[model samples]
Target: MKCWCGKVLIIDTRRLESKFRDDGKDGLIEGVNLKDRIERNMNASSYPFRVDDSCHIFRFTSTGMKTIEKVVVFDPLPIPGIYMLVLGDFDEDEIDVGVKSNNRDLEMVLSTVVKIIAFFLSDYPDASIFVEGSSAARNRLYRIMIEKERKNWRELFVIKGIDEDTFEVFQSGKNYSSYLISLCKT
Candidate 1:
């Protein structure tokens, strides 16, 4: 199945099932140190999400001045064990990722995204989730959200930002073209 982002989701169910079953002894990537974890308070709120049977897709409703159906898809990338996080509105028969729903619920939507990420990592602890916005402005928005939650999230994830093909530890004030997140070793 091909996603709206044009990336073909070649889901090998057997491979995924096996990966999910394996113990995550080697989950943490090299070069990440335990001292790098950040601690802070996270007081964000989110809408409850419903997961599909495959657990690759999640749905939630955004309620504010307007009601919008939202879909979050964790599509497999070409690289093994990596997936791209796609967020979009659930249009009829398709997910329109480019559409900007001015629902005035940015914080709730982002908080819900974080919740979904946590849930996805619980099943695929070693998998790295990639996120890149549909537009430059949207990318900036994502960066801002990440920065706001960086300290709180660092305790749970090893967040990295990609700039000019280089993946470095995510830092505030630095602009990145994309982001990668994986479960932090407990």
Candidate 2:
């Protein structure tokens, strides 16, 4: 989808996965951290997508704050289907979301994602994205952020969950999440 700040694109999970296997990376348009993700994901748990069937992406911005068009790839999970699940924080961590779909078209899915982000940018000044339904799920989110995003990724970092009850910030490589984390906490 097209937007004033950027464009969003989604492709089939099979196509995305194949690209990752071929090139060792796919990126925001497809996904990220291919080779490392593949090796690490060998034993990653898979969840039934029933709960995720209605998944949506949301973005937010604080009053008078700038909208940084950074896309964070969060909770990248490989489901047993032709797709990989992707969650991300965007507009400089002002927004958070996950994308899940049974649809076959990537563009449609991603267009919707872009629209959702736009809504957050245009509307909600304070909003929270997904947290695990259980403590373990939230903890898993933290570990995933630490393990995958702690490297060469330039402009994105996952928001860490503290104790699955309160949220905290952790430094990922060169990124200082204090400011961003503070925004998220509210």
List per-prediction Cα lDDT, in the order shown: 0.75, 0.30
- Candidate 1's C-alpha runs over 4 A off are 1-41
Q: Give the candidate number with the greatest TM-score.
A: 1
Local lDDT at 135 for model 2? 38
Looking at model 2, the pairs that clash are 10-106, 74-87
- Model 1 TM-score (2 dp): 0.76
Q: Across residues 108-134, which tens digit of lDDT does each residue of candidate 2 receive?
A: 233333233222322233433333322
- Score every model by TM-score: 0.76, 0.24
RMSD of each: 9.0, 17.7
Instruction: Put down candidate 1 lDDT per residue, 31-123, tens digits, no spaces.
Output: 112212221234576776666556787777899788888878899999998999989886544557878888899988997788788778867
